[model samples]
Target: MKVIKEISLLREALRDKRKDGSTVGFVPTMGFLHEGHQSLLKRAREENDIVVLSVFVNPIQFGPNEDFETYPRDIERDEQAAYEAGVDFIFYPSVEEMYPHKAGVSLIVNSRTNVLCGAKRPGHFDGVVTVLTKLFNIIQPDQAYFGLKDAQQVAVIDSLIRDFNIPVELVPVNTVREEDGLAKSSRNVFLSEEERQQAPAIFKSLQKARALIDSGERNPEKVIAGIKEELDSSTSGEIDYAELLSYPELERVEEIQGKIIIALAVKFSRARLIDNIIVEI
Candidate 1:
C-alpha cells in the first residue's frame, strides 16, 4: 500500500486511477484504529475496486477546549490495520498541508448544528463539513463509508452531499460494538476501569428507548425521560443529552411515526460516550 502525504500527489494519483474507471472507496478518519474503523475498512474492501483510508487528525473539527492535541495517533499501527484490510492508499496529510493558509471562506452548517452534540459545540459541524468538502474534492472517491456511531454526522453528511451535488455515494455502516453492547470507540480507552463496566448501560438505555417505541410509546418526552432514568440508575456518568428526534433531519417530533433516532451522550470522568438506536416507527 502507498502512503500519500501530499494533496497534489493524491489528486494526480486519483486522476490517473479514474481514467481506468476504478471504483474508489474512501474512509476518512482521525487515526486511532479500533473495531469501529476496522468495520468500515472491511466493508470498503468487500465492495470497492480500490480503498483509500485517510488518517489525518483534522484540527478544524476540534473545539477550543477539545482533545485535538491529545487525540490519539499511531500511524504505524494504523498502517498495519489498513494494509490488512486491503487499503490501497493512505492519505495521511499534515495540518499545514491541509490548511496552508488562514481560511478565505468556511463552510457553515446552518441546519443540524443546533441539536445534540452539535448544540453544545457550536461550529463543530462547520469544521466537519469543511474538512469533508476538502477530502471529498481531493479524493473524489466513488463512495465513502462512515460508521453510524455518530448518526448525527451521517445525517449532516447526507445533507452535505445533496446540497453541494458532490458525486459520491454515502454508505452508513452500523456501529461496531463490544460483546456486552458497549459501542466500540477509540475514546473507550480513556474510561476508567469502573467507568468501563458501566459504559454498556449507554447502549442499554438506547435499547430501552427502542423497546418503549416498539411497545407503542410515541411521546418524545416520555421516551427521552425513560432513557435518562435508565442511564441515571445504572451509570456513574452524567447525562449530556438524551434526545428523540427525526432521523437525519434531527428535529423534534410530536409523536414517533417515521424514521427516528434515540441518541444520547454521557460524560464520564475522562471520556464522553455517545450511542444511539435508529428505528422506523
Candidate 2:
C-alpha cells in the first residue's frame, strides 16, 4: 500500500482507481490502530474496489486542555496493520498540509454538540466537520466507513451529509469488542491490570439495559438507573455518563420506544472507555 503525504500525491494514486469508475471506500482514523480499525478496513475491502485509509491524527478536532498531544500514534504499526487489512493507499498528511494558515471560516455544529462526549469538548465536531469536508472533497469516495463506537460523531456526520448534500454513502459499522466484551480501543493499553478486568462490565451493563428494554421496560429513567446501578456495583471506575436517547438524533425520550441508544462512558484509572447498544423497541 502506498503511504501518501500530499494531497496531489494522494489524488494521483487514487486517480486511476476512479478513472474507470471503481468504487473507493474511505476509512478516516487517528493512528494507534487496533482490531476496531481493522474491522472497518476489512469491511471496506469487502465492499469497495479500492480501499483508502487516512491516518492523520487531526489536530483541529482536539480542543485545548484536552490532552491532544498525548493521543497515541504509531504510523509504523498502523502502516503494517493497514497493509494487512487490504488498504490500497494511506493518506497520511501532515498538519501543515491539512492546515497552513489560521482559518477565516469555520464549520459550526449548532445541534448534536451539547450531549454525550461532545458536551464537554467544545467545537470538537466543528473541527471534525471541517476536516471531513476537506477530506470528502479530496478522496471523493463512493462510500465512507465509520465505527459506531463514536456514534455521536456518526450522528453529526449524518447531519453533515444531509445538510450539505454530500454524495457519499454513510456506513456505520458495529463497534468491535474484546472476547470479554470490553470495546476495543487504542486507550485500552492504559488500563491497569485490575481496571482491565473491570472494563468488560461497561458492555455487560449495556447488555443488561437492552434486556430491560426488551422486557417491556419503557421508562428512560428506570433503564438508565439500572445501567448505572450495575456499573456502580461491578466496576470501580467512575461512571462518566450513562444515557438513553433516540438513535442517531440522540434526543431524550419520555419512554424508550422506536430506535434508541443506551450509551455509557467510564473513566478508569488511566483510560476512559465508552460503549453503547442501539435497539428498536
Candidate 3:
C-alpha cells in the first residue's frame, strides 16, 4: 500500500481514482492500530473499490492534560496492519498539513456534549468534530467507517454530517471485543497484567444491566444500580459512570423503554476503560 503524507497529492490521487469511477471508503483513526481499527478497515474493504486509512494522531481532538503526548503510536506497525487490512492508500498527514492556519473558526457541538464521556472530558467532542471536518474534506470518500465502541462519538459525527450536508455515508460498525468480552481498545495497552484481567468486568457489568432490562425491569435507576453492584463485586476499578440513556441521542431517561444504551466507564490502576450495550425493548 502507498503512504501519502501531503494533502494535495493524496487528493490528486483520489481524484484520479474517482475519474476511473472507483468508490473510496475511508477509516480515520489515531495511530496505535488494533483489532478494533482493523475491523473498520476490513468492513470498508468489502464495501468499496478503494479503502483509505488515515493514521494522524489529531492534536485538536486531545485536551490540555490528556494523553496526546504519551498516546501510543508506531507508524511502521500501523502501516503493516493497514496493508494487511486491505487499505489502498494510507493518508499519514503531518500536524501542519492538517492545520496550516490559526483556526479563526471551530466547530462546536452544543447539544450532545453534556453526558457520558462528554460530561467528563469537556470539549472532547468539539475537538473530534473539528478534525473530522478537515479529514472529511480532504479524503472526500463516498463512505466513512467508525466503530460503535465510541457510540457517543458516532452520534456526534452523525449530527455533524447531517448539519453540514456532507455527502459521505457514515457506516457504524459494531464494537470489536476480546474473547473474554472486553471491548478492544488502543488504551488496553496501558493496563497492568492484573488490571487487564479485571478489565473484562466492565463488559460483564453491561451484560448484567442488559439482563436486568430483558427481565422486564423498566426503571432506569434500578438498572443502573444493578450494573453498579456487578462492577463493585467484579472489579476494583473506580466507577466513573454507569448510566442508562436514550440510544444515539444519549439523553437521560426516566424509564428504560425503546432503544437505550447502558454505558459504563471505569478507571483501572493505570488505564481508563469504557464499554456499553445498546438494547431495544
TM-score of each: 0.98, 0.98, 0.98
- The local lDDT score (0 to 100) that residue 163 gets in candidate 1 is 97
- What is the Cα-based TM-score of model 1? 0.98
The residue pairs in collision within model 3 are none
User: In model 2, which runs have C-alpha deviations exceeding 4 angstroms?
Assistant: none
- Write model 2 residue lDDT over 1-281, tens digit each, in one string: 89999999889878877888899999999889999999999999999999999988888888997657888989999999999998999999999999989999888999877888888788899989999999999999999999999999999999999999999999999999999999999999999999999999999999999888888899999999999999999889999888899988899899888998888889987778888988987
Encode model 1's per-residue lDDT on 185-259: one tens digit a residue: 989999999999999999998898889888999899999899889999999999999888898899988988889
| lDDT digits (tens) for residues 82-180 of candidate 3 | 989989999999999988899998789997779999999899999999988888999899999999999899989999999999999999999999999
Point out the worst 10-residue segment of candidate 1 by lDDT.
13-22
The 0-to-1 C-alpha lDDT of every candidate, in the order given, reads: 0.92, 0.91, 0.91
Q: Quote the lDDT for 278 in model 3.
A: 90
Number of clashing pairs per prediction, in order: 0, 0, 0
Per-residue lDDT value at 255 in model 3: 84
lDDT of 1 at 240: 91
lDDT of 2: 0.91
Off by over 4 Å in 3: none
What does the lDDT read for residue 176 in candidate 2? 96
